[model samples]
Target: MQGENVSLHCRKKDANSSYTAKFYKNGISIGSSSSGNIMAPTVSKSDEGLYKCSIADAGESPESWLSVADLGFPQVLPNRQQFFQGEPITISCEGLNGRTGWRVMKKINGDIRICASTWETLIGSCNICNAYPSTDSGEYWCEHGEIQKSNSVNITVSGHPTVPYFKFYLVLYTGLSLLLVVILLILAGLFQHHKHQQTIRSHTKEMSLTPDDDTLYSKAIYTTLRPGETELKGHKKRAD
Candidate 1:
């Protein structure tokens, strides 16, 4: 099982002087001991591998495989059932017993995916830096091997509708500009019409004040005969 102390021993056949026993993991040298015994304390998933030891003159021992098993269930931090899009979340498989090697798994869109294999894992926990409603929303759990798995958690991600500030302001400004131009054009047309009407009225008043040709001739004749003929005309009318 995981998180357990492990010890390997190697013995030489004949009684001899002290010799250093070297330990190898997966054919690579790990450490050496003077007592012909090597100890690995609190072994985890990373410690599980092929192990062998050898003395200086003696031959190497047969390789043995180490297997680590998960201790408990998995847990999700923040422990929320609902989340918004673009939020970060973490899924941890470090159970109550402090065991490791349990992988985070999810079923999304009817397909299963393993974290750190499909996505990214940070500090031994599966991290979704930017979540999405369509892709990241699903059932999540932890699995140690093919048979052992923790309880699943249903997660729902909600997407919020957003409008671009630049585009929205651009549309608003364009509409206002067009409306302002229309208003200015209407005002200019009305002003021109008012000015034309004022000019026409001024010209008509000047024509009415001026004398015509017939009126001017009658006035001149009356002014020429006025002084002498005025009293004579009255006397002639009385005699008739």
Candidate 2:
């Protein structure tokens, strides 16, 4: 009896209670008393397996066997489990059944992804932390070993597809091209206006000068600078 009280009873020839009692577990003597009975209370986890009780009477010993099973490993179920992408998951193992380790397996698009560990107790479920759709998506299961396995759980990754956003990008690119053409046309118009302004300013400044007026203007400036230079030039021309 693991984690329970135990009593060693020796069957008598006629329930006479006239014999002595002794107990042995796994072939080791545990307790014996002269009162013909033995009771062990609060049996710990270590006490398990087949036990035998013997009674010595009139120089004869008779023995009988008893089996005690303890509370051992935890339970592992398959029907109600799941897995998701980017989230690593683990499963609990039971019995001494060669856990060796546990493998978290998933059938992802007809492919398998597995992770293994040797533990009887699990701190978290098989669905790992912070699971996301694009990175971690697939059908999954918790595998114990080649000998023992659990049920399969499909991991459906839910998210929006990228195709619609790509189409939006194409639409934006076409709109940008139209905007660039309009900007170029506006710039060309502004350049034409500035060139026209420069031409008008040049034409207005040159209109103040005529061919005859240019000669009169030069004579006026020459007469003011020299008093008799023109008369001396005429005398020198006559002498020659």
Candidate 3:
């Protein structure tokens, strides 16, 4: 853990195979070898997965669980956060190096560099690598072996607009349009209420001018008729 020199290994003679051997971590089936010994590159958090080696042949069940230890991914740092597509991007990964697996690594792209004699050898170099618009957009993670992945350095590249961009724009405009429609509906309701109040006032005045004989004993407009308002309207207006 302190140095990258930790080894959790086992041999394969327990099996019936004169064949090669393979190593695994947290159930990750890895490389094969003719020898019984399996060596670890560097261990890290991502390597925290279960580790065990399998023989090419069914020698014996002795190749069972070897190690279930926590593996840390090496830390990688990038020079800049942004880049242009098809351009170079560099990321510096930090970890103890030397034990054979010290190589610059790229996941999903499988670009493993071998100058990894020393951890510092790859630093300052910015881990220079190329970026393509389609492939490199996601998180770019690197590790020595299954060791800690270098601290992620994202190199987002600028690119030409695609059809998806247009779809996004259209979705945004549709959302705005719906919001505007709701606002207009609310304002129209308010305007209608205000106009109804003015109409009620007009109806009251028209009723006020009605003859006293027709008025009978009521000053309420419910006793008189107003244009556009019938008995049904009068009953509804009075209830309001």
Candidate 4:
């Protein structure tokens, strides 16, 4: 809410024992404090911009966007019906009455949420950080003392979809693994076949040695019988 005190913290970058921080808005120095927090006593439209903080010995922190909502009739800023997942949203309820007792109400996923009075400010606004598709997308409105004070705004939050290339990689991995297994099986079969061929060749060599031994015995018997026959023929010739 405008005129409400807001605090911006400067997170420390280094492991310094003590921190003296300077706050900046869009490259302009707002204030310097020892507590490392910049306090805006009364925030206005001019207070909104990219904000950061820097320490003496340390460097500057990353910039953050600061949005200030104008206190108009009770409503949601940028009254859009659709919002993406993880988007920031602001709900303001500054009606004809100026910041007396206003609360932000949201109905999401069949549950209703009522923001506390302490959560509201003179600006009658509060920030919803990182809206979720499942939890934060719903109808939101503002109320004051049991009376509906603002227009109901329905917000739709859509999450990022699954990437196509991710599934492609999954299929690719499956195919490669199957192909590798098949190739290994083929190599194993070829090795077994080679071992079987070697065993058959060894068995054939043993059979060939048996044939050679038979042939040598036949030749020896033939030579011995032929000499005996020659002796018998000589004896018959002598008897005659």
Give me the candidate number with maximum lDDT.
1
The candidate 1 region of ten consecutive residues with least summed lDDT is 231-240
Residues 134-211 of candidate 2 have per-residue lDDT tens digits of 444665544443333454445544444355556888999999999999999999999999999999999988876645
**Candidate 4 positional error at 153, Å:** 23
In model 3, what is the error at residue 91, expressed in angstroms?
6.4
On the 0 to 100 scale, the lDDT of residue 92 in model 2 is 44
What's each prediction's TM-score? Answer: 0.35, 0.29, 0.33, 0.32
The alpha-carbon deviation from the true structure for residue 189 of candidate 3, after best TM-score superposition, in angstroms, is: 1.7
- CA-lDDT, candidates in order: 0.75, 0.53, 0.53, 0.70
Q: Measured by TM-score, how close is model 2 to the native structure?
A: 0.29
Error of 3 at 11 (Å): 14
Please identify which of the two predictions, 1 or 4, would achieve the higher lDDT against the true structure: 1
Alpha-carbon runs more than 4 Å astray in model 2:
1-105, 111-137, 140-162, 211-240
Model 4 deviation from the true structure expressed as Cα RMSD, one decimal place: 18.0
Task: Give the per-residue Cα lDDT of candidate 1 at 148.
Answer: 49
**Could you give candidate 1's per-residue lDDT for residues 59-115 as a string of tens digits?**
888999988775554566667667778888888887535546677888999999886
lDDT of 4 by residue, 1-103 (tens): 5545789887675645788889888999888988787788666677789999988777888899888665444455557556667778777775534545677
